[model samples]
Structures are given as structure tokens and as C-alpha cells.
Target: MQIATLAIIGASPPVRLARMPHIELPRALEDYFAFAETEPTRNGRRFSITLPYMDGERLDRLQWWYHVSPAQEQMYEGTGLVFHRTRAIERFCRHIERWLEITAQRFHGEEPIPRLGQQASSVATPASVELTPVDKVVNA
Candidate 1:
């Protein structure tokens, strides 16, 4: 999973580039990442990804922040998985794999539930391979 530059399709002028790999999460996990947010701060960039948020059930999403400092330092402790913060992106990817494993068990081998926070009534259009810097695809 080497980092690569992604072109910002349909982005406004002064286009931005995200220095990350194409995420491999699928289905509901895919939808969850679709709403992922990236905030540019004076220190660096902060990327946020979260658990399934459908039907407006508030379950302390504030704890899911992902921070990347100016020196390329990263710290992220998944709100649902292990609480220990990690600087390695591969560890975070493992966090996602762990979530998928548990979620599959939770669903009893059925398709993972769509993110409840989106209030999506359907599970269509999972993700975007290309997009603008701030683009968010609504599942509903």
C-alpha cells in the first residue's frame, strides 16, 4: 500500500491532492469511509473515519479523530477497536480489517449494515474511486 498522488476530479481551482492509497474497504465499510472528512489545520492535515452511523444513533463519534502533523507524524486510535493510538497507517488498516471481521460476526454472515448516521434507507452506491478534496457521497 504505497502512497500515491490522486487526481482531484471535478475539484474547484487550486486543486488539492490526497497523499494516500486507494482504500480497500468494502460495502458498509465503504459507505462509512465515503463520509470521511479531512480537515486542513495550521499544524497539518487531519483525516477522520468512523464506524457505521445510520439512523442517527449517536455513539461518541468524537473519539474517532485521525491526526497527521506537519512532520508527517500520524496518530489515530479507532473509537470502536483498540483505543491505543498508532502512528502507522498499516496498523490503522488492520484496525479496519478487525472491524470488518467483528462486523461480519455481528451480522451473522450477512451483508454489513450501512452506516446508520447517514439515515440511508438503501445500500446503493458504496464509494468513489475519484473525487474532489471535500467530496462526500451520501448513501441515501
Candidate 2:
């Protein structure tokens, strides 16, 4: 059994977009799921869909680190752990699929924009002019 970390974001409850690593799938598995939607994120984007899976736990601690931590550095600061279990890969896939579908439908068109690192150098405008560049000239 392999462990996978799925990220979800949206306004509504219990819906999420999942980002998964590339892997091979059996032909029989393709029919079991459907692509529901896609949404952008701070880094890039995510895709959503529906599939089959069993046993899902909405983790509070994990959610806090993944979703809430980056919002305000002073408030919540910590590293997150991966929650995993030995279950059928199919089941894991399915659970993520359902989450993606729900999250997509809720925040369909709107996606969060990532914050840029820092503000650029302040540009002085005519109204806020301090000193003219001509005044700095030295007589030669």
C-alpha cells in the first residue's frame, strides 16, 4: 500500500481539488471515475473528479497545517505530517476523487491567487516628488 497526500481548497464544506503524482492505471480502472472540474492555485492548478474509495477521516491537525498555517506566520507555524493507512490503492483514489468533485463544484470559477514574496521598490510619482534629479548635478 502506498500513501498519497491530496490537497483541497474551497468555500463550501467537504469539497476539494486533489493533486496527485503521475502513475499508471489499469484499463478497468478508467471507467470507474469521471473528471469533474479544474481550478487554479497559488503555485499552479488542480483537477477534480469522482471515484470509489472507503474510509476517510477529515483530519483537523493536518488541515490546520496544510490550509491555515501559511495564512499568518505568527498565528500558526508548524510542519505537517502525512496521514496514511494500508488500504487498496483504488479506495484511496476514489476517496480523493469524491473530494475533488465536491470542492470543484463549490468554488468552480474562483481560485485563490498566491501571494507574491514582497513589494517591489516604491516608484515616486509627480505628486509625491521629493527632490528633482537635476539638482544633484555637479558643476564640471
Candidate 3:
């Protein structure tokens, strides 16, 4: 088994638009990501999600480190998914796909954006389109 973590860093506008007002990046992420709880820290919230193997064994984890200072300030966040089982890599990749989709809808008005670590290349595909391979997504 191999262990690794993949993350994407995204930024949202601080000021509210005429239609969309007060979209707090961290709060929006916590709401859409659907994590159990956030640990209160001096700076912000520490959110985590854990997935175990089918045999009820602890194996992988996805962690998000988010910090928001003041309601109207820009949000800087990192979302990382770590896994130890190479066989279950596809599952983790799908999870990242959904996370990015929801986040883009919430903040970017459903506009398709590029992958986190890549240039201005489009990452969005239609519903009928097949997803990119797990290796590509992980490397992206």
C-alpha cells in the first residue's frame, strides 16, 4: 500500500456581489463538504473526514485546513485527501471530484474552473462525459 495526499487551493472573492452576498468560503466549505465537526482554534476551524476500509479498519483520511478572518475577508483554504490503500485510490479521487464541483457552484456561480495546481486549462466536463483517470486527477 502507498500513502499520499492530494490537495487543491482555491480562492473566492471577499466582497459580496449584487446577487450573491456574504459567501463565506470556510463556512460554505464546511456546509457543502459535510464533515462531522470542526475543532475550534485561535485562527479558524480544523475540519476532518475519515474513511475506513470495508473490513471496518482504519485506513484513509481527508483533511481540510481552512482559515477565515472576519466575515468579509478573502478565504484561503487547503483540502487534502490522504490514503494508504492503493486499491481504493479511485474512491478518493471521486470524492475530490464532488468536493470541487460543489465548491465551484457555491462560489464561482457554477462556472467551470481549471484544476488546482494546473494552468488555465478547463477541468469541467458535462454530465455525460466520463471523468478523468485517477492518476490524472491526483497529479492535477
Pairs with backbone N, CA or C atoms under 3 Å apart (clashes), candidate 3:
none
Candidate 3, after superposition: displacement of residue 136 in Å?
A: 46
Backbone clashes (count) for model 3: 0
- Which regions of candidate 1 are displaced past 4 Å? 1-28, 53-64, 73-93, 96-104, 107-140
Clashes of 2: 3
lDDT of 2 by residue, 57-83 (tens): 221110100121223323212211111
**Which is superior by TM-score, 1 or 3?**
1
Worst 10 residues of 2 by lDDT: 59-68
Model 1: how far residue 105 lies from native, Å: 3.3
Model 3 worst lDDT window (10 residues): 78-87
TM-score of each: 0.31, 0.19, 0.22
Task: List per-prediction Cα lDDT, in the order shown.
Answer: 0.37, 0.30, 0.32
Q: Model 3 RMSD to the real structure?
A: 19.5
Candidate 3 C-alpha lDDT tens digits along 1-140: 22223332331322221222212132322223323436555664443444321112323335433333333133223212112121123344445546545555223222122113212335676579665756543443
